[model samples]
Target chain A: MTPITADATSLFDKLWQARLIKDLGDDRGLIHIDRHLLHDLSSPQAFAGLRQAGRPVRTPALQVAVPDHIVDTMPGRGDATVRGGADMIVALRRNAVENGLRLFDIGDPRQGIVHVVAAEQGIVLPGMTVVCGDSHTCTLGALGCWAFGIGTSEVEHVLATQTLVIRKPSSMRIRVEGRRGAGVTAKDLALGIIRAIGINAAKGGVLEYAGPAVTALSMEERFTLCNMGIEASARSAIIAPDETTFAYVRDHCGSPEWLPVATEAWTMLRSGPQASFDREFHFNCTDLAPQISWGTNPGQTIGIGDAIPPLPEPSAPRERASAERALAYMGLAPGQRLEGLPIAKVFIGSCTNSRISDLAAAARIVRGRHVAPGVRALVVPGSSRVKAEAEHLGLDRIFIDAGFEWRESGCSMCVGMNADRVAAGERCVSTSNRNFEGRQGPGARTHLASPATAAASAIAGHIADCRQVAGR
Target chain B: MKAFRKVTGTGVPLGRSDIDTDAIIPQQWLITTSREGLGKGLFSNWRYRDDAFTPDHGFVLNEPRFARAKILVAGPNYGCGSSREHAVWAHLDFGIEAIIAESFGPIFRDNALRNGLPAITLDGAAVSQVLAQLAALPANRMTVDLERAEVTGPDGTAYRFTMDEERRRALLDGIDDISATLAHAPDIDAFHSADRIRNPYYWVQPPRD
Candidate 1:
């Protein structure tokens, strides 16, 4: 492989400039999309729009379809398992066949959440431009790719032409220094960052995570970090590709044949010493505790041992109003400790924290104890391959023995699109991304936490810290 | 996409922040492949009272005076959360031609632009003043002029804004994104050839017949 040239620009700029097909001025550019990911919920309308416009997919080979969001994740589940989802599932399958595109259908070994499948199959690589119809597509940015979510109209536009007219977002680099303490994980760090900076801090900007703490995280942990970039309302989130990234991609299924060449190219995909950003932020996770969301939005969070802060005076009207509303919706008062709040259910899966390490973290907590009486617990892997690997490691047995339901892969109970859902009026501790009002279900109260915290909460029937359970 | 030059309509003031798309149109309403009839589902959770389907008169949109409101004025971060375009479709179907907010979610703003609805952003003070003025005079309307890049409130207060020139032209010409993208075919071809050499593995080879 020839030596790749290094540029004195940020990693984002390098990838963005490479994909620019035409600059339309005023920051808007038409960039060629190297990969387009589609799912059952968003792609049906897009495909229908393409058909209505008498257009065909420009590059069918670059597109991959999966039925994750609306598919049932129950064991032995078939296409008809989800109410009102059968049509969507069937439509996705039909569209894939009609367009001659590759699809990881239900029961396929490669089928899983679209983001997980893309990473596991090595389709999303360093320095590539990837777009998807889901907000969590930012997860691919962890692999050093320029990735972001698009609406159905943009999805249709990409289907017709493998390019999108996008405005260049200003860049922000968030540096996290120092080593993380025990019981701290990527989910906790992400929540802590969102709490420190309001949800809109990174709006209209791409966040490049750097520093010792970020580099110390594993590839899956980095995915967990980038997965919630959308929660911060960021255009995307990325990390420079390093040896950890190269090794993960090399070991994943369907890796490219040209490994050495890819590695050499990726080695150059980093920001130079003089690279500048529109804004910069520094966060220290040295003493960070396992974080938890106390209110409806992901930004309304606190460390596990800290009490919820009181709603401040109305001088900052927006903050006061948001805090009051979140408190009302969550049925909590200010200054209350979140630790003893009884939880009716616990979910240990989602695109945010459903990787193998996430399950292992939860498994370690549930190994000897059973879920508290009247509390329901579930463990859903992010992908079918993750499920197989977990079962091979006997993680499923541990979960089941601890009174938790072991389910197949898919976005189960995350968005509540399928039969798996938190019943109305029930409070749940979930490891998913969003904690919006009625996000899990109508009138379902959710407290977002890490996988270990979720498992510990299930055993204690409340929002308990993982350290306490481990101490027991 | 329909061409948009100007729109004049009564503004419905929804003084709320972080109004996510899930609340705009619930996940249950996303069952249809068609974008039609989503207006009925817009804010369905807030519009209706219970399973028996009692109308909630307290909801702002349910008020008789605001029944025909074609403009929506909201607080910051309106249309945050999910990237579902159905939120825009539902608002458009409900006769909303324009939305004025302090800010908007990037994806939602892009979706609105492509769907021919203008998500105009104004400063917080300007939006607050507009909302207060509209609240005092419910019959007063606002005018959004895409050509001039300004919004005129009923009291004749004007808020200036800016948009991408290409998107502005595409919206004015009523041209879909596909047509706009096709105009750059030559440039796209050039980039594709160079990109193929630089990142060969990024391309997925077609399956053999």
Candidate 2:
């Protein structure tokens, strides 16, 4: 392949400059960006840094700002209920308007989780470099774009220079084969992938999903997989564009440019049957059970009903030390059964698996079942649009009737960013990524699981295998 | 504005492993855009009952000894999950001068430095020892001397550490990196005005192949 190095922008470089790229794939194979995402959390200092540099945003019109992380999840109206959430919305709106960018204010039908709305509105297209201040920006990989999270300074750098300096990442290809097991959704497939390679295995590289199983997934399912790339410690995850992707974009966006731009870029993105990867891992979906992380890290996972791995004889001092420490904090015995380990809460929302599909999965479990006594369960939607769609289908009622709190969208309980949190010493089976200590709150314990597993845990009041309850 | 200056303070011992950011300032607090007074909200859910503003007896922050902690002694892989700087700021706002952990999540540590909070890592055992000492004497004062690259506890036991020399210099001078970047305004203006090329990454490249 001829190296095409044209005078174009890289996504990271554009983030530094805070400018929009005219096109992607300059003859050099580097992709430029059409839009950038700014949020309340990362954009404040970016603006401050720009002020310090005495420059306005390069192309604010191409930028979009929304509040997702800190927004309150309470559904009630009135100033107090919207208190903290409204302030950030006000600040973001002020910032966007001042910078000449578009502001999607709270309550606007267009207002939803940034990634979901971006894909739904066709703002994120195939073959674009989309940088957001949030790491889950990798979700756009489902759209065939190179999107990932960046830092506050990097946000400023992009705003001021519209470019970021970055080294091209090495690549890792994860090929999923065979049809998915009945009742096994994309959440299971993603957890299965993370379990196989370990979270840090894909770090510093771009991971591409291929093979029949991945292609067989819906756009929502693919998004669910790629969206959690950050949780796997990877730089990003991308799925080769296909008819389903084009259809999703076309149907949601309905623009003349969708087909033309998608068709053109999708062709360039596939790993030419002979393309190479720095590393490769393959999985057979047929045998994989609904997966979940029983330990404190996403990598400390096991199949449903499997006991925690006996502390592997530490081949190295670090591994031994880590195992000893993990065992101590989680109050678990090596080789202890993860089943029936009582839980205090169940959280089912995050950029990782909180799409509409995830809701449906949880609803299926919660439909006729009440949460086991004392297990505080909440079902948070990923975006307002997702919430609306689920509500339209009465999915919210299914959960609410089953004693789950149906709340508004945002990264709720995923990172413990807002008021929703698991109490200290409280254990939870969560559908979001990352089970690191205190992820739900100080001294709180997290067990990462799929929506189905989380719902099962809610019913059993512990870590129960979904297949046992959902019945394969 | 005053120049950024190095801050020296006592290290509070938390001694817990895998202390992720979600625990630092749970996600429920991220909704508001206000950066002011987040210290109160930091670890709030754990410290207080859901509807009760008073302290929760079982929570870490509510524990008598750690009520006024200013420095955290943590285990490995601290600050994992979403790159929200709010977690870092909440810690800083709560008067946490430094975090002594086994390691840090890449972006979370960077966010700490940019906001004047230094996340220092040392041997896990060493951190545990510090935690024990702090537990033995809850009010034990430990100083983080950036100039000396050392942290000394109330008992005078010292641990050697390292920080980015540039960031250290900036902190000691009380100036942020962005301010430092701007101090070279004349050079930057000259560079931008020169025959610069735009790279594929959208950054202005120096005029050269």
Candidate 3:
């Protein structure tokens, strides 16, 4: 290891300083925003605010808008087909047109979940400051960007001035060492990290993934791992740029001539050999299994073969009560094992696990097998390009043959913004990020898992270990 | 934005941790272009009975005593998940002027301040004390004093809190943040000029469709 030098700076510290438009002192600064992303659900209010205030977009070229959350995801989907989202889509299109901002409308082949679309299009680059109206914007941090989620008010601020005043959040380095077990995908690693750290442990702070396992993940898998940053409510989730990131960037970057120059500069954005952080967490992934959340919260997760532990003792009243209530709402007991717990629905897509690689993984499991009786399974791709690529790979046919509804791209049942909600009083095994009460639908119970686990569970009509079911 | 210096009102306790924005206002209610009437959707799944779509009498917001409460006290990580500022708008429209908690989701914390609602955070013990005090007496009035940088509870207890200096000044003045940043244009321009030279790779905009 290199000796600690006086200038050994962390990745975030370098980005924070590089983007500082004006320092306000006390860890607060007016930072220059490199890219601003807008979605139909949150951009309308921001645009209206700007209109009311008579403010023009300060840097329209740096902004991109899409209608992902509220668009219908049917095969031949149109803007007006969504139950209550037509107005939102129309509003976003109008706002984008008026502001001269780039937009991928409903029929555009590039339209997708803002985070996925941003990374896929190379709009978000290493060491850039990226913000969006949606929390999952942290997913772009997988490419080594200083990216985070912000509210609509901040969105308006960025549109108006291309700047935001923010405090320098503390840092946490999460080290995932060693390769994961078979069938233990990136989704499982994400859930396992959240399970180790509670929902709020890293709130108001940034988290950087390091160590051997994180460095070895495929670019798409890194996106899956970083996508769950919002589940931890982090200020941002990040990984330093490496050759893996540079390879992906070389393919997607808009300016081919700039790749060598950009990659060389971005290589310096990595944390110094002797960098320090406020907090550090280490997890060994060699023996990690496919994780599933039996309760409402993502942190309330256990391995595939594990049973729900006994309720917490009263020493911590809030946690105990929360666990007790989650148990009641999920219709499970203290010792109930997740395996074989029958489910009514299976959703195998989200910004976290809907990439082509993720779809391919699920297809490999359900090639010849059919979904079990009494189960409704759906696969919503994260973007239009992903859907096209998936179809090109013949994964759609495999899924359709296995009794899965192959749908278009958008944030579907993951958020129930569209009409893809799980029925009330029914249980669903989903590959989405959160399992909170009513996250999919009112009174709908959700269990978060990997694409493999979700597909395997759908075939068995219950929660099952993907490794055990993959052979069948 | 409304100016927020001090607020004194009855405290309503919702003793749950990780109260995500989805639980605050579900996507079902986020379709509207306007920000008004969002309070009806605040805690939608919990505050409203599913079948009837009427207020659930058991919900604290539906209770007559807590209906008039302008301050809410909750456990850790209040307003976690989702970057929907609708949660803050719903709280403001619902007459919730301030929130006291152990910790808050970072985005929610900023959202609340930008909208002139101070998201006051106390230590876990103090938050528990406040929740207990409010639950024991639903009629208890609490004062969140931004000027004093503390929360004065029903029993005349004061818990000191911290606030971002710039945000506190902005909330106190109810000024547009854009205007505030414009005041430092020289510094911003200097940085912009330097950034163009230092980071040319980021300046390449994507070609049109």
Candidate 4:
């Protein structure tokens, strides 16, 4: 990265300049990692590597660990509670203890998914460069940070040295203007974007969201939107930190004495007036409806009111074949509407949409209704604080009384590493990000949607829109 | 990490898009601490029949003709969804040395390069030409020469691609990334001490117990 010239810089360029340690040549830089989050599934190997190499974590104070991926979501669960997860959790604990890193153990109130905890505890502040081993680490970009995921090898590099060799991705701005409809949400906005544009539209670039519709979203909604950066093939996504971001950070940012200094610094985290991106995509969310994935991939989506598209014509042979396979695996016919399709299960949790506000949105839809007779519904909060806040506000009671199971926080049903998997061949409407074939479980068909849609689908035993459920 | 120079082997064509890591290796096999012996679980969903491990003859990997395949020619976004290194490990352990696709998930590409597995990108027309040749004659030989930055297809078509200079250099020389960063520790530490004040809230002061 060159020194800032008279040219107005984009938000990504600004963040890149702040975090760059040195330009290691070849368009790659040795960037300093301000905060590093670790989880059970990917960190054990990295810690093991550190042990083998006799290298200590360069900055343990900037690192934190929480076992979320393979942990059981059952109430009163412990480290040894999960069948295949106990050893991973134990390994993370041992590694954290050995490295002098903070570990949110099973009983700790802060124990949760890595992304959610970073937001709720202020582990990731605005304008910093954060990274984790999981792909959804981009979710932290909601706070106007350059956060993205890395693989296990990259994770090991980060542990041994608090720097990474990252290629500076070109900047791309996705501006969502106008007003989204009543029931449409950030989840819907993300799916609609992916559907309108091919997943590779933002490939090899860092995406920055702009425009009034994006700024109007709540912080939690912004988290959900940025979390799907990987789905659109972007390195990461960021929204300029505004009043909503400052208020949220102020609530959890420890050391009130330092918040002013931090906030003042964050104020400069926006793009310049004449900032230009390498590419730009502008969308109007006025007619965007709550999106539902009809096929296996996130891009294979349609609005709730629309029917599944027919197979692509022979002109695009590759597209035609892919659609054929997705249709066969999903057990759906062409031109069939996503609504009124019978679903066997409902999952309303993930790093994507398991926050307190997500639960409240679902609660409003399921307020006075009972789940359908045959549908099994589960709601797992994203973090301990989220679960506690939902209970304090009686959202948990509304879900439980309405026949949805209230579960402890973890990555439940989203990845289904625990015992919360959907049975084989069963169809489920989930709030998680990916809908790949057998992502929920082998032979399980998943329809990715928002929490509100998941809750309403559970009540109706079929795909249903929250707007109609709320009689809006 | 192994050093990559060149490889000549038969190629298998997987004509599918959005082949996510979840499909490459399922979530059930992700609990292990080690990445060894994952070849058995590579595309287990598509390759095996029932819990009894009956090899499905329909899947290309299970077919006898492509048993010695060392290169995978696949559709776009070959390794999308989830930042699982197990996808690269499984492919490497399953006797595949490199993957040539229309495009790949950026994280997967980085992981592959770090592990000495080259993720070569070719345009759609080039990928189709290669896949069509493999479909007609499964035993046709192919070559991926990293030094030359070119891939020789079964039909004698050579497609050139580009890669980041630093990553390509490291993979070719098998350079240890951790040690490389450590060699420059002085630079990192200097920046850390100098910029610590700018991010006052980013540091944690509570002592670790």
Clashes within 3 Å, all models in order: 0, 51, 0, 0
Query: Could you report the DockQ of all the candidates, in the order they appear?
Result: 0.59, 0.20, 0.72, 0.64
- Residue A287's lDDT within candidate 2 is 85
Give the TM-score of each candidate.
0.97, 0.74, 0.98, 0.97
Lowest summed-lDDT stretch of 10 residues in model 1 chain A?
A250-259
- Model 3 spans with C-alpha error above 4 angstroms: A1-7
Residues A1-472, model 4: lDDT tens digits: 9876654898889898889999977788899998889999988878877888888889988889999999888888887644667999999999899889888888788989899998888778889899999988888899999999999999999988899988888888988998988989999999999888777777757889889999999999999999988889886889999989999887776447877877888888888878988888999999999999989889999999899898899999888998999999999989999899999999999999999989998998999899999999999999988999999999998999999999888998999778889888899999999888888888889999999899989999999988888721
**What ranges in model 2 sit over 4 Å off?**
A1-32, A51-54, A78-86, A255-258, A470-472, B1-19, B23-79, B86-106, B109-209
Clashing pairs in 1: none
lDDT of 3 by residue, A1-472 (tens): 9865565799999999888887788878999999999999988999999999888998898899988888888887778655667999999999999889999998898998888889888888899999999888888899999999999989999998889988889998898898888999999999999998877767668899999999999999999999998787677999999999998987777557878887888989878877899888898899889999989899999999999989889887888898988999899989999999999999988899999999998888899999999999999999898999999989999999999999989899999878899888899999999898889988889999999999999999999899987543
Put down candidate 1 lDDT per residue, A1-472, tens digits, no spaces: 9876645599888888878888888788898998999999898999999898899998898999999988888899889756678899999999999999989999898889999988887778888889999888998899999989999999999988899988888898899998888899999999998888789888857999999999999999999999998888886999999999999888873455687887897898998877889888999999899999988889999999999998978788877998898888888999999998998999999999999999999999999799999899989999998999999999999999989999988888888777778877789999999888878887788899999999999999999999988822
What docking tier does model 1 reach?
A: medium
lDDT of 3 by residue, B120-185 (tens): 888988888888888786448999998889898878899999877777788888988878877887
> Candidate 2 residues A1-472, lDDT tens each?
9986453433222232332222222211112335688776667766865776688785564577777766667786222333455566566777788888766556765666787777775677666678888877888888777777777766776676444434356677888999887567787788778777766666546778888998999999998889777666665788878888888876775545325644664555565654667788898999887776766767677777777777767565555666676666678877888888999999998877788888888888778889999999988887788889999999988898889998877767876756788887788888887776666766678887888889989989888878778532
Candidate 1 runs further than 4 Å off: A1-8, A253-257, B204-209
Write the residue-wise lDDT of candidate 4 on B1-209 in tens digits: 78898999989999688798999999887888887888888898898887777998999988777888899999998898889898898999899998999899888888899899999989988998899999896456999998999999997889998877777778789888899889989999989987877665666543223
> What lDDT tens digits, residue by residue, belong to model 1 across residues B56-122?
9999888888888989999899988889899999999999999999999888989999999989888
Q: For residue B109, give model 1's deviation from the true position in Å.
A: 0.7
lDDT of 2 at B7: 42
Model 1 error, position A21 (Å): 1.9
Best by DockQ: 3
